[model samples]
Target: MAVQEMKLREKSAPARVRVVVEEAAPPMMPVIYRRLSAESLRQALRKMLLIRRFEESAEDAYMRGLVHGTMHLSIGQEASAVGICAALDPTDYMTSTHRGHGHCIAKGAQVSRMFAEFFGKEDGYCRGRGGSMHIADVSTGNLGANGIVGGGIPIAVGVALSMKRQKRSSVVVSFFGDGANNEGAFHEALNMASIWKLPVIFVCENNGYGMSTSSDRSTAVKDVAQRASAYAMAGRIVDGNDFAEVAQAAFDAVERARQGGGPSLIESKTYRIRGHSRSDRNRYRTKEEIEAWLARDPIGAFERQLLRLGFITTADIDAIRADVEREIEEAIAFAKASPAPSIEELTRYVYSD
Candidate 1:
């Protein structure tokens, strides 16, 4: 990292308060683009930093015996969730999976409350009712994170259906992993979305493996995007590690959906550096595979691209890192300081909060 990038990470959150004065917007790419101005690039980079910091923090806490349950970190694949989310409006809906921390942050979820929920506090998104696998912020249009793989796809279809019925212009983005493509629910949901021409962008994040099983062994399709043809929808494969590609793909899909062009599938070919879960030994794959993916670290790659393009200084990235670290620390403090839901409060929301 350059000196300027270092400074950027150090002053992360404080810089966000300033207004971005855009003299002229950069050219938009229908397929892929990383041509963001310095300020916009900084903001996007900060979000990726935030997600990386947040998940790593949660993992550290889990190891230290702070978090009580399972925690799936979305550390390596931050670009897939964050960049796509940047293309969305607050009114648009998205459904998440077990590895949902990145999704939550991308959907504008409150970081402090998310931490509170992780700590089982009363102020959590689910008010402490839902734990790690069930975080939900309805206000942000993040339908609760599903515990079951591929479970949220159909639900997102339904959400999109409602948007269609109401003519709301809002589209539902359904994010599932490569593992989900093998599931029956994924196929069923795609079928329905295809038949109805519902505005749903099915983003299959092909992170190479489905738990312990390699996607190569799990499915015959070279790319999950090819399956969209069977569903009668347009499909495209993208470099998921590239934020520009991700943002462009999402923007194209979102605009098409808004224009009532129905569903599309985007296969974001990326990798998850961590194990399937916190407990994963990660020995199922070879060291070379891990090292290869690490070489293409999405956040680091984007940061380099931004710097080379003169869009970000090293100071910007460093300031972002520090602010993200502090934010995570503050979240930890908030979660620890907040009270656990009272036994009395448990029955409260069950009836009426």
Candidate 2:
């Protein structure tokens, strides 16, 4: 446990410590969240690390010919996924983007099952019907990962609508990139959610680019949060790479929605560490830009935060990384021995009775 730790650098005072456990819990804008217990913090960090390792291994598996279809990596975007996930209860639903492995892990989906699903095995969560792009664990309140841009946004709004109509307190969150913000569905969903005062939070992970296009090149407005005002909802612009800040902001919005305060838009200004997909040459972005974001890597940043806050020992972190790597390796093994879904079963799940 003897390890030199890092310190928590304050970018801004965090919103207050009002964390609601259920969908109906009240909301508050705390300056900063009440410091989570070491166990709580550790669990969140472990999940994030697990996500990082799982994604890295998945990428390797795809390269090794074990997993088919497109695979998205959430390597550098761990905190944005994990921290917000920490703010919610298991009953709260979530919708994920194409690069949604981090969301899967953070939302408590089983790693082995996810891998099996990706490998198209019968034991997989979706029974091999949904592959990398369509992973879902209903037990964890994950609706599913949508392949289409802005596709899940409307779905999340529907879930929130259902929650309100049924007198359910659960809030639903939709995680997407800035590219999704420009979609017509995004505007439509936001308008409805605002009008209905639906318990939904639109989480925009502005990772600088949509596929290969940079944000500035594609987006006319500098801030996606600015769009929130059009809907008359709260707009929170935050550093997505900062785990604490992201978690705090999300907690506030989710709580607000739970208590009938309505929807909020959180623009998490972060970056992607990998190319848009496995085959991306990354020619659209400069090497220096990637390097700059890497310098502030979310995983490394959080690890340092734990160390500085004396929340975790070097031994603890080492154990965490080692365990994550081991779990990922196990997932790969499970995936390798698995068989692909049969060609004869293509018509199943295409329609529900």
Candidate 3:
């Protein structure tokens, strides 16, 4: 009876103690600002703010029926554009996606001309022939922003080829979305770039969704950087929200390409705070998901970092904001005052022959 009682007591005792496995802390990213000058940091902040304000204003213009046709805004993905472009030399070339205003702005295109182009004015790039999705500034090495998904990949490869043939030291950077990775052009361009060892950097802005479809449903690979393996090139994943991280990856990739190390792929995991287009109601995502991303706003986070690092003060930030606001307002005024393209010049730029 005593033995039976002891057996029962043992059975009633708690099972083996459970041990929780703690996850390791992520490694620290390099301090990019330490290597950059104060002027560079200020410029980055200014450019990022300018892109945000410009996008906000553009949205308002679209709603007011001032901008015609469809428009894609990179409101939340400014860090990826600015960070990567800032890592490049002034003479380096870059191709942008439909959501490319930020890329143009980061690469030093005049805001007045960008607004003028949207307004369809004669003084605008492309003389108002190209709308929001087609802005290009050859003088600044901005090849142009493509409307078709994955359209700019091959164009960037072609530019790289031209540079290679000319024996130029310049490199080309191609920016595209997660959706573009599924396209055939992406595969073709990467393959050719690989075989020829073209001086190009293929940047994939994996913003979680391609239109309304989540990347989880569309892409087979969890990380777009894995695609580089198929091409036998180097690839990396970066925190697109962290400007320092993106800039570091871009710097390494740009340096590699410049040194004839061939092409590299960088997948920047980011999110779009705004809808895919003006007409989108964003019903596909939940408020909770959006709020989570909003908490990680690149501009706000960077501002805090700058303050904490003593790189800038609240007053400095405010001054930068005021300056950017004034500049954007002047750009809008210039666009408003500029005249539309003349009817006689309609067919002038239509044909190559």
TM-score: the better of candidates 1 and 3? 3
Best by lDDT: 3
Deviation of model 3 at 171, angstroms: 0.5
Q: Each prediction's TM-score against the native?
A: 0.89, 0.89, 0.91
What ranges in model 1 sit over 4 Å off?
Answer: 1-37, 351-353
The most accurate candidate by TM-score is: 3
Give the C-alpha miss distance for residue 196 in model 1, angstroms: 0.8
Provide the lDDT at 80 for model 2: 93
On a 0 to 100 scale, what is the lDDT of residue 339 in model 2? 74
lDDT of 2 by residue, 127-151 (tens): 8888888888889999888899999
Candidate 3 residues 1-353, lDDT tens each? 11110110012223221212122233443577667887898899889989988887787778787788878988778899999998888899999999999999999999899989998899888789998899999998999999899999999999999999999999999999999999999999999999999999999999999999998999999999999999999999999988888999999999999999999999998998888987899999998888667666777767667766678898998788778888888999998899999998889876785
lDDT of 1 by residue, 219-338 (tens): 998889999999999999999988988988888999899999999999999888788886899878998777667666777767767766677787876767777788888988999898
lDDT for 94 in candidate 3 is: 96
Q: What is the C-alpha RMSD of each candidate to the true structure, in Å?
A: 6.0, 8.3, 13.0
Compared with the true structure, model 3 gives a TM-score of 0.91
lDDT of each: 0.83, 0.82, 0.86
Model 2 alpha-carbon miss at residue 314, Å: 0.5
